[model samples]
Target: MNYEKRGGGSRSLPARVGRRLWVTAATALVLTAAVYTLSVRTVTGQRWENAVLAGRRQDETLAAARDANHMLDHVTVSSLGAAVAMLMLIGLARRRPALTAVAVGTVGIPLLLAEVLKRYVLSRPELVDAPARLSGNSFPSGHTTIAMSVLFGLALVVPYRLRGIAVGVCALWAISVGAYTVAAGWHRPSDTIGADLLVLAVACALAGLLARTGRVRPATERPSPLSALFLAPLCLVTLGGLGGGSLLLLESVVRLSPADPAVPRLAYAGGHALAAGASAAVTVVLLASLHRIDLDDPAASP
Candidate 1:
């Protein structure tokens, strides 16, 4: 397989990479702000999210709650340590220390940022007369952050050839975790969306750093088409089906009066579907952005 450099003539590789990175990071930041504003700072947003929480008892079965709890139980400090260790092992095995460091940063930075934003920087004001359970600030959920950061970290470190397979498998877990956060009433749909976007912004920034440092290169071999063929349609279908379904569900909620008996159930279902769709969209974005680039061997770089 032949790998070609990305630029020609006056345009430099680093320049191109940096431009793309800035654009993506800016977009993620704007989206994060939008999620916070629309979902946490607005009355309508608060009403719907609170309604979702209220409906959890009706929609979430005992077994389903248990399953969500069991899934969340896996997101402990020990598991994060193990995940970091595994990512480090991959970098060590490949003899790419820079890649390893970036991979670790990709995981650690978002987790820390999510905590800071949820705890200190951002706040959920008393925008609506909500229950005590729904009063606190829970944007950029820690559990969803952990799941997404780990998935993005794994995607960052895996070999180019295996990138699609690795992301495809891990995306399912990440997507499920995001949805489970809502299903368990631990987070709102926007919380999961915020986490996904935070991870994406950090990942893009780090990839840009790698490119600027000359630690990124074009792939030497073509990625397996089968992975794309399989994963692309899967993501598209998920995005379209769940996204469309959630819109319809939420549209009904919007049209109905707040006192209607069906509002809670509709909002809850819509929020759940929205959470899953957001995760799927994030996975697709990360895969598309990363599939073409390979981490350069540090020793081989000039």
Candidate 2:
């Protein structure tokens, strides 16, 4: 009976991990391909270009309060390198070697891929109706990728008790960066969306790999401290989405064209905001779901 119990229980863990790895890899590949196609092809269309252009030019209507470009300017390669180094230090301080490795792969692979895609794999096509559009490729916004990856990575290494708060903060940070890029004209909505999807795919793949390797096996655990803190951000995201969507609908009803300028720009900016909120919600959900699986928390919601 002892021998039978030992063999069966030992094999089950690997079998489960193998299944999760296969599923995660397949899903990630499909999502990455789909986002790549949309970003590279569909978003270059006149409609999308005009909407994005309007959003990018919203500051023109508002005149001078703040320079949106400031955010993108500071998110340079050097800044990202420093941020990564800081994150590594934090992970080491916690003495979680395996979790730190997972965090690095989750963030590092996506960062590398974002740069590669931006520099080589993708290109922004010329816009016919939107002749004033900015020149250069911007399929995957590097800033958004960096922000999201950092947040996601940090969430993975944080203690189980603090995971919920980390997830919430990460979601807010990612959304802010993504929205800022769209408003600053550094990237179109599709670029930021694609960046989020890409980061998510890489994070999931890395998580699955770690699980399969038995390097970061999930252990049954207590619920995180202040789990309710996570709910507030998710609620805020929902409200923001609803408000933005309503504004968009009103703009459409009023027949505000890109030619008129101000109203359309307002609508476009609202759309960008909505996208940010949606992306945040998705990120939060993903983190929560993964946390439940990783910690073996039976009380976690779907």
Candidate 3:
């Protein structure tokens, strides 16, 4: 059933959309601040040495993982462009004008923001004193931001009934891309985390815009119990990933050895991968909730 109610009910659509926007904005701001603190203050001074060693170890680990590196090598701008073009094509073929809008907004805006922040807004402090020779600003990882934006955009445009699977696949894609960048030494764990938050903020803002403009679809059938069941395991996996990653990070930091940095470095990179996986899982869960709102109305029948 289509709902055109604007202000008649206390649980109106606008109010709910507004609430979501506020929460997203607040979370994004807090995360951005935390990232800045880590980049500028926490990782400098005595901790700089450890951070550099960990990064080099991550690079070494990636060098050993030939298969993983080879797979990630194929994820270039040209290929991603083609994938994005195909996503747009799917939206157009579906004849859903809103899908096209959502796709463009979700992918385009975050990409632009990622570039601007890396270039001008956020600065990568000289925290790593190693001879590893850092090239670009590494506040928010550009590769990660691009990968996640595309994944989230694709999930947003797909059919609601298919969204659960879409989210799962996209989460895996995000995890792989995130891990690849970390292992390649293109980014640190913090960079990946920042990029995730930036993309999420853009998506949330776009969703609020759509909801406010009355572009959201009407109430549909209630969500299936199986849908909820499907997401539970993913959430647990995310929790496991985060826990494992955090433990390794702690071990790496506490057991930092300048002479034999290999073990610590391995732990750091492995932890980063697990952290990335956890971040992906969280993103999937957030998007799934939004999909539920789009497809399932609690007030409606199953």
Candidate 4:
């Protein structure tokens, strides 16, 4: 129970948690701002984003669009409500009311923030001559936020032993949702990336709150090595492959004129890769942060 001695450090748990929270929040803010600036505030950024949208040729992305739409269709308000309720039920079943509240905040706060930003705070100027539909403000995709928030909520509420498995499963789904938004043309890659960053910031803030409340504790049980062995490689591969691939594709098209027929197709593929990679990266970071912290405080539980 002596956390101070266990970590081989003089700083308390709250201090450590506070430091992480600040670092994560600052990083998220900077990244979010960068995404908005590059993708919405500049002509080149607009051209690139618009190219991705235009590149969604029916012959190329039809199957992807179909699958993406099918996945996105389940992100209605009712479905999200039910998902939140299910996460709460899991927390209650584990006898962690405080954790349950944190889980709810983790899911709800980001969605609310995304809505406000998209509707009022953020704007997409006519940086380039693009279709009205493509120019509308959708900086942060609501569907992506919902997917990530649900993933974070579930990660918080699940048992420590099963945390790895739960996160692995849910992270895949969340990554898919982000990529799908791009493929379906419902959102730009920036929107999904922004949503991922927003959810990550909120998640870190909520985790710090839990630490301040003394709701976080050291896990009594040892985590399985299988999760580390499996998830580490999976995350690394996904992050490296997709992120690298996206960069390569974008780089290849950078010198090409926008009028080139290949630009749109390459941009669209790059955007899809970027969206999925960003989601996976965020999910991996969240899981790493929660590695040894137990959300349930047994002493505080009934």
Residue 19 deviation, candidate 4, in Å? 2.0
Q: What TM-score would every model get versus the actual structure?
A: 0.92, 0.78, 0.80, 0.92
TM-score of 3: 0.80
The local lDDT score (0 to 100) that residue 24 gets in candidate 1 is 86
Per-residue alpha-carbon lDDT of candidate 4 for residues 1-302, written as tens digits (9 for 90 to 100): 55567775423665576567667867888899998998889888888888888877533556766887899998898999899999989999887888898899999999999999999999888867877888788989999999999998998889998888788877878878888898888999889999999999998888777766666666778877767765775487467747775775567357446567777877777887788888888887787777677775666322
Task: Output the better candidate (1/3) by TM-score.
Answer: 1
Better of 3 and 4 by TM-score: 4
Off by over 4 Å in 1: 1-11, 297-302
Candidate 2: residue pairs that collide? none
lDDT of 3: 0.64
TM-score of 2: 0.78
Which pairs of residues clash in candidate 3, taking residues 3 or more apart in a chain or in different chains?
A: none
By TM-score: ranked, best first? 1, 4, 3, 2
**How far does residue 203 in candidate 3 sit from its true spot (Å)?**
0.7
lDDT of 3 by residue, 176-253 (tens): 787667666666667777777787777777766655554554436554446566566567767776777767666666
- Please give, for residues 1-85, the per-residue lDDT of candidate 2 as tens digits: 2212553553355446546655655665576567557545653343544555565565454432144566667777787888678
